[model samples]
Target: MKTNFDFLMPSVNFFGPGVIEKIGDRAKMLNMKKPLIVTDAFLEKVENGPVAQTLTSLEAAGVDYVVFNGVEPNPKVRNIQAAKKLYLESGCDSIITVGGGSAHDTGKGTGIILTNGDDITTLAGIETLENPLPPLMAVNTTAGTGSELTRHCVITNEETHLKFVVVSWRNIPLVSFNDPLLMLDVPAKLTAATGMDAFVQAIEPYVSTNRNPITDGQCLQAIKLIEGSLREAVANGHNVEARTAMVEAEMLAGMAFNNADLGYVHAMAHQLGGQYDAPHGVCCALLLPVVEEFNIISDPERFKELAVAMGENVDGLSTRDAAELAIKAMRQMADDVGIPRSIKAIGAKPEDFELMAENALKDGNAFSNPRKATKAQIVELFQKAYDAE
Candidate 1:
């Protein structure tokens, strides 16, 4: 156990059902009289969607706001630029983001540019920001990403077709709302993908080189919660109890990875997400078992502990055997949630593996991978993920 480690999360977290309704008051408390609401066009148009609920709360609180519903999945630098333009034009005093990771990330990027006055791309790496970002609040509608609680934001470069990660404590949301009710309407496939993303978040940190006792506890608890509830959440999206559990699991996993950082699963997945414009969770789900399989050789005991955390019965099993069981459990959970069996099914081509592998090696998350991987080894891992069943 490390004698010293840092733990951080949003200062104010409103969790559970009906908590979103207090967004107006929360904004007021933060002294955000005028705010820019960053979200996706889908959420803005969906009848009675989470965006509408957020708007209603803001109106009731007499808060003035402008909406920028241009964020896209795997949000790009252009998205932040456009949102920052809107923020400046509206004279918004603060920022509020609604929906999932894309929206939160876009809001974070905009907040960074708003204060730092730099191209979003310039602030891509860890602790690159010279100034603290403007106050931003995140209202999460997905039980995944945990972007609301974490200080990391991922943005894709359209020109390079590569994703860049930004890690800074200044990017953490000032306030966050996680209401399972808002997640009830998410489609089953999205629910499954996002749930698996949360699962990867928990598992990867458990085996990360940065793992500490505090993050280990959070990851283990999140693993148990996801194991018990993810399938239910995906199979029955309207199940409030299951959804609530999944959200809690995601938040815990976020806290774990937010501090310990992630590993190759995220590092590799980021490349696929940037290249194919794929769903982040689906990319994570497809790559997780493969990356962990490669990683198990580095920390068999930790992998065995992960198996126990995921509810695999490894009694009387050798460390290697128990570690393998963790991979099996991860595959089974992903299958139960209907994730595609291979990355090839999600539009990744065999020829792109080399370039993706090269980029994966450059990703910030790769530094924390339990095992160091050469470019050829990363290419092999991508090939394995592509052919995985």
Candidate 2:
């Protein structure tokens, strides 16, 4: 075990059924007068959606706000620029992001550009920001991604078809809200994908090169929660208990990954998301077992521990055998929750594997993968995911 490491999380987090009602008061406490609410068009369009509910709360609290509903599923650099423009024009003093990872990522990019005065793409690597950002709050509408609590933001470069990860403690939201009520309306497929995304977040970090005791404990707890609650949350979106557990699991996973970093699964998934415009969580789900199978050779004991954390029965099994069981258990969970069986099933083409694999090796998260992979190995991994059924 390493002697030193750091763990990061948002300063304040509110979790429960109706904790979103506190957003207005929280904004006031931050001295934010006219915050920009960043979100996606779907939320803005849906009747009585999460964004609508947030707006109602802000109104009741008498907190002036403006809406920027231009975020996309893979959140492009253009989205950040557009939101930043709106924030400046609206005279917004702060930001409140209301959605999943995409919305929060867009808000983070907007804050970066607003503070650093450059194109968002200029700050796309570890600890790149030199200026402190304006106050920002995250109102999570999904029990996945946990972008609300993390210091990392992923933004796609629309022109280049590449996803860039920006990591900085400065990007952490000033406050975060996880209200299960906001997650009740998510569609089943999305709920399944996102829940699996959270699961991968926990597993990857548990076996990451940067894994420490603190993150191990968090990842274990997250894996247990996901194992116990993800299927129920996906199958019955209105189940508050399941939703709350999933939310907590996601947040715990976020804290683990935020400090311990991630692995090739996230690295490869980001490429698919940028290239195919695929859902991030679905990409994570399809690639997770494949990546972990490759990774198990590096630390079978840790993988075996992960199997135990994921609630797999590995009685009388060798370490390597139990490690393999972890991948099998994850695959079964994905199947039970309706995640697509393969990358090919989710619109990924084998012809693009070389390019994506090249980019995957360059991704920031790739640095912490339990296994150090060559470009050829990454390409083989992509082919394996593509050919799996």
Candidate 3:
């Protein structure tokens, strides 16, 4: 363990039902008279959706705002530029993002460009942002991704078909909302994918080389929460208890990974997202077990712990055997949630594995992986995931 580490999160967080109704008051408290609302077309268009709820609150509080509903899946650089242009043109003084990772990331990237005065791609590395962002509030619409509470902004380069992450304390939102009510409308498939995303986030951090005591507690609890609620949440999105557990789980996973960092699952999954335009959560679900199979030898003891958190019966099993059970649990959870078993099912081509592996090795998250993998090994991992049953 390191001698010291920092725990980071938004200054203010709201959880549970009816918390979203407080957005207007929170925005007013922040002196946000005029703000830019960043979101996707779906959120903006849906009646009585999170965006509509936010607007209602803002209107009641006498706050004026302009909406930018151009965020696409795997938010691209141009989305940031466009949102920035709107923020400038409308004289908006703050930002409120509504939706999952894509919308939140678009808002974060816009904040970066507004203050830093450059393309988002130029600020892709860790702590590269210099200026403090304008007042920002994240009104989360999904219980997945946990973008509402993270300092990481992942934006895709449309030209190169690569997703790049910008990590900075300044990127963290000033406020966050996690009302499970917002997630009640999500489809089962998406619920499964995002839940698995949270599962991967928790597991990756638990075994990270940078793991610490604080993050360890958060990761294990998050794992337990995900294991207990993900299936029920996916099976019945309207179940308030399950939805609440999942949102809390995702937030905890976000907090842990934000501090402890992640490993190969995210590094490789990001490549799949950029390469095939695949859903980030599904990509993560597909790669989680495959990557960990290569990494378990580095710390079978940790894997055994993970198996327990995942509710596996490791009684009387050796460390290595229990570690293998963790992988089995991961696969079972994903399969139960309807996630495909192989990357090839999502249109991944074996021919592209080499290039994707090279890019995966260069991803920032790769640095904290428990096992150091060469490019050839990463390629083999890709091939294995593709060929997995």
Candidate 4:
């Protein structure tokens, strides 16, 4: 309920089919003549990736550019350094990221180092980036990550397994593309995982310390869109309307979490991603219900909204009972989506729990959790996550 607040997003956004055509025009407006298109090698070969379209548009606009498609999922620090080297060598003045969060983050991490000299490690934490990163545009392929609009990038340190969140106002893309058509060829498993990622964003922000009226509206609406459409998108991948709803859900969730921040699910999931190389959304799906159940004791009332947004009917249950019901609903959703219930099932070792918990407690997102946790408590949460449910 703070009277003063702040919001972050792309200065311009394009939603719906065929909006990718304006990508070159947007780059021209940014005074970007030579743009570097960042993406992964796999996506570069895929039918739906924006590499071809982006190249076509940039060429038509008479913009000079180079393609650097060596990025990988759970992208690493070296990826940024390599892209930065290419950007410098090719004389690219701007960047266009044309895949998922990995591509978007690679562009951002590279752009930061490109303008600010080198030693990419200097831009590690929040606002450590003092120099303005080159103008960047994010043309997102996946509906999740919301990286297209958010000013946060999770770049892993290859040697340390540390997931550094580079949060700066400068990281927000100049414009974002959410054309559902780009998402048409996404496989069902990934569709489910990223969709749940959006769901967690909305749910976590509802109870974050920084929650405000504006973010509240966005989070709840995003949650509803996800609960309604994520399954449809997963079951019938070609359902354009469902895909459209899912894209909206991801977009709204980005708007919500970008400003309000997130909760323990993301904090713990970050550790899993940095440590075990787990899919970000799969780790979130495993941790979401566990964290919710652990957190409900602190704010049972909040789960009322959580339950409703997750599509649970709270007819006559007590707040505590309804909270448990919400947890059940989330667990069911995870099961339905084929997400494994435990870290052990997903190849995580029980011995790793203590260190993972240790790292999880220190994640900045944990600072905003409604139920503040100690290291020992996080260890307990990890133990629960270790045993396959």
Candidate 5:
């Protein structure tokens, strides 16, 4: 039996070693007169950084812009509201977001409600947005998440302590940027966490209920890229070729998961990040192999493919053993990248696992998991993550 799948990405994307320098004229061609630049403060202060380089290029090309550097990790309602206020005040008409998934998502969220109305909460969940959002651009700094080219924007609801995913084709950026040059100064720990995030995204989609051959192919290729290049990227941030390869892998993985839909690992990780204010990639790292290990029994052959993609040798092993090896490979990769093994070590409480599990079931991404999980099963998975230390 075969199932159908649809794939999607941004309208236009620039991916290579130095594509960030190409954005100025691209924005101009779209008639963007005033582009609101959204991102966190950390990168904005470094005049020698990518964001500043973008500004300089825009200035040289006579592109008008304003900077709103207030977006935070797990972007909040307040963050969007503040950016929206600044957007209106600045008389900006387009948006240029430079950073990881959070920056891109925050830019999309703000553009949506500002052009439509206030009360960002009404846009939560899937495909609930009515009107189209404003024109946007995404320049990614991490080799993971790949949010720059996707239509999904994950924002946190501060009041309820749950993550809200606002998804619509309108939220997709007009131009997605992938410049490995921006990746040079990224810390080793972040490099590993983000790299693993891409690996999980690729792995989740390949085994998803919604997966089709097109998506599975994309995901499998991405898996191979992450497995081969992540360690080199982490060990030597200055390695240009390694960083470029990672960006390519991350872009493909993003395309895979955004349309194919993610699964339990993302569902559980989202809850952890929203609840604990944890790093999104770090949460994904700790829970990914645990979920996949539980799922191997359902289709050990497919799991064997995952192991092979993770750079494991399955030539002589049985399917079941190959799957087990895949899990071990994933764990070792995380450890090598300095990702903490336990959620408890990162401030997650054991008692909260039940609530996190309950919310995970409601996540849009969880519905596509290869293995159907009961609430109790999800709870157990959470317990495993909690006790991993």
Candidate 6:
């Protein structure tokens, strides 16, 4: 942690039901003549999905775009290469990403490769990019991951079977949109996973070693909002109030972690995502409780605060007891939202735990964990998460 720190976010952000409607005008304001639209195949195929809506907005604003919808659930290095190729060949001057983390990260990685170098692997660490990215706008469809407004991008290497994070202030999108209306049709399981991802994002930052007062307030408020609305949003995706609340919560959590950094949950989850090709949010949900349990002794008072933020009734309890309630609350909330309890459910094997643990310790997010974990302890956490029930 530094005595002096900088707070960062996109210069322009719009949040509301129909805020996506301004994508075209926003792009024009940024002077985007022809932008490459990066997204996943599912969104491209949906008749009225996020990509289609973005296209409608762009066309209405007379902005031309070429679409690359090959992004995977966990975007690979090749995905960035492909997107960058498309951007150059199509004569695009800007980039617009639709959907969540995968799409947004693909766009960010492409931007980095375009200006800094042709290879993205060399730019994996913090503050490695020497050049500013081309104009980029992230129109977020999901309320999870917060890639839309963050300075982080995660890309998987196919050959090594590992995920690497790219952290740079330059990776922040020039504009961001969080429209709850766009999230109304998300599948129940996905909604649950994403909402829990947001929860972990909040909890991890609040307890992070690098946390400052601004991020602490953001994380706690996000925790409270998620506790109040995530369940309803998962149970009934059409619930506008719940959906809107989740959008706010996810954005706040994103902003919090963007500044405060994250912890072991993200570090370990990245390994699982790269190893098994599991859903990122599901990996986070399964690992969060186990890692936080290990982290409780680092800051029991903070855990007690988290308990209250999660709506746990910890009145008159000892700090340690209240902190234990926080863990229980996490378990119950995950259960209520249909998150699986074990990494075993996602195909993570014991034989792979040692390597995953080693890789996790090297992850950028691991440095800020409230507890400095040894490789042995990380492996133990993986085993505990795998055997959880």
Best candidate according to lDDT = 6
lDDT of 5 by residue, 1-389 (tens): 12755668887889887688888988888888999999889999976798898898788779999999998988998898998999899889889999998899889989888866798777767777888888898989999998998888898999888997877878888888898999989999889989999989888888887777888889989988887889999999999988988998999899988888888999999999999998899999999889999988878998899888888889989889998998999899899888889988668887888999999998888888888999999999999998896
Question: In terms of TM-score, which candidate is stronger, 2 or 4?
Answer: 2
Per-residue C-alpha lDDT of model 1 across residues 1-389, encoded as one tens digit per residue: 45588889998999999998999998988999899999998999988789999999999999999999999999999999999888888899899999999999999999888888767777777888889888899999999999999999899999999999989999999999999999998999999989999999999888888889999999999999999998998888999999999999999999999999999999999999999999999999999989999998998999999999888899999999999999999999999999987999879998999999999988989999999999999999999987876
Q: Per-residue alpha-carbon lDDT of model 6 for 201-305, expressed as tens digits?
A: 999999988899899999999999999999999989999999999999999999999999999999999999999999999999999889999999998999999
lDDT of 5 at 255: 90
Tens-digit per-residue lDDT, 1-389, candidate 3: 55488899988999999899999999999999899999998889899999999999999999999999999999988899999988999999999999998999999999999999767888888999889999899999777798899989999999999998999999999999999999999999889988999999999999998889998999999999999999999998999999999999999999988888998999999999998999999999999999999999999999999999989999999999999999999999999999999998889999999999998988989999999999999999999999999
Task: Please give, for residues 1-389, the per-residue lDDT of candidate 4 as tens digits.
Answer: 44589888888999998888888877887889888899988778865357888777877787888999988888898999999889889988889999888899999989887777676665665677778889899999888889899988888887988687878888999899888988888999999888888888888888888889999999889888887888889998899999999899899999988899888899889888888777888889999989988888877888877888788989898888888888898888888878889887557776777887787777768878989888888888878887646
By lDDT, the candidates rank as: 6, 3, 1, 2, 5, 4
RMSD of each candidate relative to the true structure: 0.9, 1.0, 0.8, 1.4, 1.3, 1.0
The clash number for model 3 is 0
Model 4 is weakest, by summed lDDT over 10 consecutive residues, at 117-126
Candidate 4 residue runs with Cα over 4 Å from true position: none
Q: State TM-scores per candidate.
A: 0.98, 0.98, 0.99, 0.97, 0.97, 0.98
lDDT of 3: 0.93
Q: Which residue pairs show collisions in model 4?
A: none
Global lDDT of each candidate = 0.92, 0.91, 0.93, 0.85, 0.88, 0.93
> Can you tell me which runs of candidate 6 are displaced by over 4 Å?
1-3
Clashes of 6: 0
Error of model 2, residue 306, in angstroms: 1.2
Score residue 238 of candidate 3 by CA lDDT. Answer: 95
Model 4, backbone clash pairs (residues 3+ apart or across chains), number:
0
